[model samples]
Target: MNEQKIFDNIKHALGEAPRNQFTTEMHLQMIKYADNLKSITAKEFCEGVGLKPSFGTEFSKMRNLTQRLKAAGLNTNQL
Candidate 1:
């Protein structure tokens, strides 16, 4: 399925949560698609994940920084 379609399905399945809970649920769902996501840029990943631009930017920053931290052998638990 296409990006929009995938997220639409995710929304249907996990749409009942409050705003913050909804976002967390969405991220958990995205974990299933990690291998597929690795090939995409942040913008593409956000689009695929069906997040609004602002939220997508935050997600992108979180993802990029987390990856950077991991590569630097830093523990994310300190965050």
Candidate 2:
């Protein structure tokens, strides 16, 4: 999917909710987007997802998720 579409979906799923309310699916969507993006910064991802770049830990986790998903050939255990 295009970056805009991915960002819109991520925003629909994860944005406007408190971080604690984010579901695993929502996070996975974000991680998948992170992986799909060839070169993106935390600031750029946050902007695209309508989030604050202050969420550094979350971004870090997303990067880790990207690696894990890639290592596993993008196969994921759906929740």
Candidate 3:
């Protein structure tokens, strides 16, 4: 996907309002879960967060964000 679209999706998933609202704690939780896991597909990850898996590519995309978010101090849950 394009960078703009990817970013937009991430923003939506994180529930950032038009006013730029965000919850650092909730993001941290998502990040933590992404870090220490194996064989955990992106579809599964999105499902855990109440998102639908639209395409097979979502897993890779989400995985990348998960790592970045984790590095940014987002806490992840153990699976």
Per-residue accuracy of model 2 over 1-70 as CA lDDT, tens digit each: 7878878877877756577877565567766666566577777877887776776557767778777777
Off by over 4 Å in 2: 15-20, 23-26, 72-79
Candidate with more favorable, higher lDDT: 1 or 3: 1
Task: Give per-residue lDDT, candidate 1, residue 75.
Answer: 55
Question: Can you tell me which runs of candidate 1 are displaced by over 4 Å?
Answer: 1-5, 18-20, 57-79
Ordered by lDDT, highest first, the candidates read 2, 1, 3
Those runs of model 3 whose alpha carbons end farther than 4 Å from true positions after fitting are 1-33, 40-54
Best by TM-score: 2
Model 3 C-alpha lDDT per residue in residues 1-79, reported as the tens digit of each score: 3433433455465675333544453344344443443466656555645556763354565557887766786555442
Best-performing candidate as measured by lDDT: 2
Q: Which lDDT tens digits does candidate 1 get at residues 1-79?
A: 5666656765665667677687676555554443335566667766655567566555555555556556788553442
